[model samples]
Target chain A: MRSRTEKTLIYALLIAGTVTFLFPLWWMVAVSLKTPEAAQAATVRGGIASLVPTDPQWHNYPDALMQMGSVRWTGFLDALANSVVVTILATAGTALSSSLVGMAFARMRFRGSRPMFLVMLGTMMLPAQVTMIPLFILFRNLGWIDTFLPLVVPAFFGNAFFIFMYRQFIAQIPEALLEAARLDGQGWFGIWWRVILPLTRPVTAITAVFTFIFTWNDFLAPLIYLQSDDQATLSVALNSFRNQYGGITKVNLLMAASLTTMVPCILLFLAAQKQFIEGLGKGAVKG
Target chain B: MATIELNCVSKTYTGDVRAVREATLAFRDGEFIVLVGPSGCGKSTLLRMIAGLEAISGGTVAIGGRVVNELPPKDRDVAMVFQNYALYPHMTVEKNMAFGLLRRRKHGGISGLLFHRAERRAELAAIDRKVLDTARTLGIEPLLARLPRALSGGQRQRVALGRALVREPQVFLFDEPLSNLDARLRIEMRAEIRELHRRTKASMVYVTHDQEEAMTLADRMVVMKFGVVQQFGTPGECYARPANRFVAGFVGTPVMNFIEGRVDGGAFVAADMRVTLPAARWPRMPAGPATLGVRPDQLRVLYRADAGASSTAADGASVAATVRSIERLGDRMDVAVMIGGTRMTARIENDDRLVEGGSVLVHIGLGAAHLFASGEDGARLGDAHDAG
Candidate 1:
């Protein structure tokens, strides 16, 4: 047991850590409400006043959203729609393919399975940058550039890390359960669909959530593949906010746009984390 | 019900590690056969082979007089209840029991496969009836609507049994199904399993490491060691006349006592102690390093001073020993005594005559003793040979 003083000290440290982590979020909301001139003035003054707004400009969100519709970039709603489309497709694709490959690797036995799994794990060592050029060329040859194909098609092929995670998760399910299913007249696909899939819901949800976050936050792929502004995702649009024509403009609107863009992800994670992680977990415990 | 037969079946893994070797067993239709041994003794492997969950490395497996080596578990006409009670946790008990039946049935009958909605509904209702009836028979009717996680250990076990029973297969394979339960629950489930076996004609091939479980449940038990089938016979035959030293030591409770000695001039002698062998049962003494095995129940305790007054078996030997310890088990007690340099146990009714650190006479009736070679795999000799 911790002493009273020790407990107080630990709590104080934790509160400090939380505040440090949340400071950027607070800064984003505060700056989003400030006038552009006040933001610049506070930046020049360099004090605690810079951490907060002097006079709030409540119309910056509407103004930023309206400016997002100009010929220079896709509007906020367009980017949001693109993000949703890519994230949902990518998440579903990844969940299905990853769990299938993982279950095959973990449960089914065949020649070269060991070497194949090791090679799959080996691919996790390489960063996306290593394959970026080749993938771009491949997409170009297939006439997939400036389309969602480059963004969503690769997810269906299965991700190595997600497959490995799913494999580890599915391996913990008892072999007897699978055998029992087989004895009950289920073929391999039937067992996977009826038995393995339901047992691995928690892992599938986790993989989907991760894929959703990764596709939403991904900037390079969309920036490189999506040539037209209408097809641009939020990350590419956000990048265009500061680096367009080599000058950061309308810092207040940028903050407002950034805050609004992150809202769906935060709300999604908060809404889904509990049901995915906790709801189906109690069934796994054997009596 | 099917008569299952294995003809010199074996399982060899990579690196030439054999899990089961040349096991040949034949079960009559509706016979409850048990495969009994210690861990890694290939009992469960043999059971799995019969269930078609494992690939046969050698020989043929026949169910209902038809070879099924190439068949998968789904087509093998067998149902297995696992040691862990492999219930589908995400489903209700009714669904778990009905899942297999639902998958196998197409409409209600062969004539209804292409028929309309009424046939499908009737088929589903039939499945529901089978699941509910099996649940009722297993006394798990109330738990049908509940998930496996909501059940107690025994309840989950019953549900697992029900799932297998609902399928109504030709053979029922149980791989240590009751081992996970507590002692009392294990005994109760054992009895229930026995009763269920009696009520059904399906041949049951059960695998368990517990010798008692094997003995009590088997119509004929197969004793295995190091992946080899050592003996196969009725439980009474295996217990009374084991085939080898390992079987004798493994089959009985409190363990059979082995005293290393040799027969000299038709009498057994070890260090300063000597025991008389029953000449009527032995007739002739084979000359070799001998180990005499006696069950704890076979040894009678006598007071050192009153040893001459008792009517000891004519062919038996009496030895003076110091009482080492006494473990009282309600109506009976296990008394450990050291005769010369060797220690032996005597199980008798609890009596006031014996005390710790006291002196007593241990009597061994050679008529009931087993003689074997002096090693781990020694062959049984003398009167205790297999009577059949």
Candidate 2:
């Protein structure tokens, strides 16, 4: 009974700590909606701040949306579209390619397969900053600058960390399924496609969610490759809005755009929560 | 059906751990052969080699008159049932059974033609019918709509069997398929598999460490140890006359007892006891101590008072033993007797009237006794040598 109470207390303390850590993000959203007057008033009042505006200025949203360009809402729409395309393509590419390659690394037999897998694993420790200049040069040569291709095409091959994660997930599958497939006239490719691919759904869903969120929220990659304002993702576009609007920024519109950017990922999580939790459990148990 | 011939087949790992030594055996078409051994004895490895799941490191594996060492498992035309019953968890039983045929049809049955939906669907439907029929045969029809996770272990095992039977392959390989079941389920499944084999008339190669399963199911048994074939013959041949000490010690329940003694004037003598042997049909005596083997059922227990005083003459064949304990197993009783400071068990039919620490007379069946040469190599020294 004492240990149970202790456990409950530990869980409560952990939830308190998590809320504490999340306060900054909550404060950012809360403060973004307030006018300068309201924000200062809330700060002066100290505990229990209000997110709503007493004198609501709904025009601040359109003003913030148009601040980066002559047109009012086109900039937000274009940036949103660019972010969606890059995220979808990158997530799909990473999930498909990395999973296939990871299955091979986990189960298949061939000369130098181990060494190749090791090399991929070795890349995980490498600092991306070291390769940024070379990647930029290569993209320039390929005429991929100012395009989303530079940001998404590399995912088709796979990231080392994702490949490692996929390989770990695939390794937990029993070898009996593969053998059973073989007896059923299934060749190597057949076993992979029919047996392994179907069994890895949880891991695939988890990988897709993480990939989508990561690519959607990334700022550095877009800032480097996307040279044109029209090609800018939401992050870069948000920066451009802040630059144009100056000190009296339309905080309400910025919060609306941020909230808009976050909604898809949140919806994805809600839709796949069961599989995502199962994937996390599977991964934990495997290691 | 196919005849599998393993010629000098061996498998050695990189660290010189020999999983299978130069083991040679042959399986006749439609025969049920069992590879029985202790744990880590490489019985499963030999079966995998026949199924082309394991590579033959030394010799050739010929199946149906073709050398299959170069062939992959898919092309080997043999099916295997694993101990774990590796059903695809995501697939329903029906879909799992049809997956193989659908794949084969998609690949033009390995000719690599363009995928045709019509032909694939027809093949899958045919396979589904066969799977459903086999599931019914295995008494698992109710589980066809369920995923593997929803089925019990026994039901999952039947699904695995159904999947294998749907292929109608030439050879069936079983790798300790009943080891995972409870005692009752194991017995039930064993009987079902035996019946299935009799009906299908397919050549089967079963691997297991359970002696009872091997004895009951195998037409011929191959006893293995340390990756070497210790003995190979009919179960009766193995039980009645073992090739060596290992086979004799390994194949029986409660095991045959071995006692050290020396032959003296056609009678084996140990300490204060001596028993006459069937000396006329045996090998020339080796000039050293020898070991005597007697099965528990072959040893008879008699109380000292039960044997009349007149029978205690100078025959030298009777021994005085102290009864250590009596185990009444409902239909039979196993009495443990301490003879010359060594415990020997005698299995009797409902002889529960014996008491512990009481003196008794143990009579050895002279004709049923087995003698082995007492050397570093314990070879059976009897007429069975000629049989071997």
Candidate 3:
């Protein structure tokens, strides 16, 4: 009987915590539907009561959309396109390049390999901001400023962390596999392409997902690199909407756009959540 | 059918750790030669060198009378079954067996028209037939469609064996292939491999740490220590007459017992035990001190010293000792007897009456005792008994 009471109390606390966590999302949607006055009232009251608009103004979405851009459904639509392109390209480039580099580092032996690997690992700790300005200047000199080139091309070389992850994952594969392939009259390239690549799907998928998410949600890079109104990413465009609209901002349209930007990332995570979690758990064993 | 020869092959690592010293061995066509030793004994290293997996640091490895030291593993035409079986986990058994053939066909290495679809299908069908036949031969026909993960340990091992056999390579290299199985499974696999060898009669070089596997399988076993070949001979020769103390201690199950003793008037004397030596040649010595190597099976534990000698038991030579421990292993009991501050183990039949802490006279069969020179370099001073 006491255990039943304890279970009930535990469930009650869990439900309360969940509601508390979800309250922000509910408020965002509620205010998005309400007029600016109702939003202010909601902010003031900080409860569900203020969510009901004194006078619902649905035109706020069109106004916010027009102010951002008419290129698509909303300003968020253009930003979504930009995010999709960058994320897909970055994920593909990072996954392929990192896996290649990782395979070499993990399996191949060459002259000065130890020192070279050390230098590669050493690049991980160096901050990205340290090289940010220099990279911008280099790209500017190369006539790449105010363009997506600044955001996309450099990722083809791969980041050190992803490469490190791939290396650790690939190293766990038995060397005997490669030996067997060799005895089957396979060249080094044959072994790498046919055996290693085929066996490394899990690691590749995890790396691709992480790279996609990182590229998708990145606001700072787009903010610094993209300048034009048309070229601006969804993240930068959202920030610009807040700047231009000020107190008269459409809560619904802004919330809608913000929510839309998060959809792809959430969907991707849902699709590969099992593989991602399993990969992480496997990595934890090694760690 | 290939005769492989290793001419003074040596493998030394960058850290100056020599995994295989200057070792020269040759295997005749269709002979099963086993490389047997403890861990870190360079048997695996030597096998790898022969397979072209390891770079030959010093000398040449000739496969089928062709120098192959510089060739890659693919060109060596040697199929090796790894200790862990090394079956490709992602591939089914059929695909695993057909991989080498498919690779060969694609590369035009195996004379066939690559663009002819019907001909390719025929070739694929031929490969399938071969795979099925090999699997059937190994009694793993039902496992052809199964992945490695779904198969039992013995089944996976058979697949590995089938994979090697399917290629029909010039030589087969087995690196501790049956070490992963349980005792019963190991015995079964050992018999299967032995029968397979008899059927195919392919030149094979097997590496294993199990002495029984080595003795039972190989036409000749090469015993190694510290990257050097200690002895290479038939099982009977190695067991009946080990060249040195290391080989003597390494081959037997319980290992041979060594009692530190000194030679005195054609007999060896330790603290309170003495054993008369048979007629044999001895090394040039001052007759001061020596060590007697006796196998456990040679030492007989008896409750009474004057029991009627059985035909299997040697005629005389018995010594008294207090029983230290008795381990009954069903058919036989391994009895460790304490004699004069040194414990010597004896394998007696299970029917023998013996108990721990009870004093029993152990018959030291002089016919099988080996004597070595005392000191750091325990050279084979002489065999106490002559097999001739």
- Top candidate on lDDT is 1
- How does model 2 score on DockQ? 0.54
DockQ of each: 0.62, 0.54, 0.37
lDDT string for model 3 (B204-298, tens) is 99999989899999999899999988888998889988888888888888979888989887667777666555444443344678888889998
TM-score of chain B of each: 0.94, 0.92, 0.90
Q: Which candidate should be chosen as best, given DockQ against the real structure?
A: 1
Cα-based lDDT for every prediction: 0.86, 0.81, 0.81
List the candidates ranked by lDDT, beginning with the highest: 1, 3, 2
Fraction of native contacts under 8 Å reproduced by each candidate: 0.87, 0.76, 0.60
Clashing pairs in 2: none
Provide C-alpha RMSD values for all models, in order. 3.9, 3.9, 4.8
Give TM per candidate: 0.88, 0.89, 0.83
**lDDT per residue, candidate 3, A26-119, as tens digits?**
7776776776666666666777576555566667666555556545555556766787788788888888888888889989999987898889
lDDT of 1 by residue, A1-287 (tens): 99999999999999999999998888877778878887666545746767877677889987776676444334777888999999899999998889899989999999999999999999999988999999999999999999999999999989998899778878888988899999998888888889888887777777877788889999999999998888889887776567557766777888888887788778878878885666346344342
Stretches of candidate 3 above 4 Å error? Answer: A1-17, A31-47, A50-82, A108-122, A146-148, A185-202, A223-251, A284-287, B107-124, B262-288, B297-342, B347-363, B375-377, B381-388
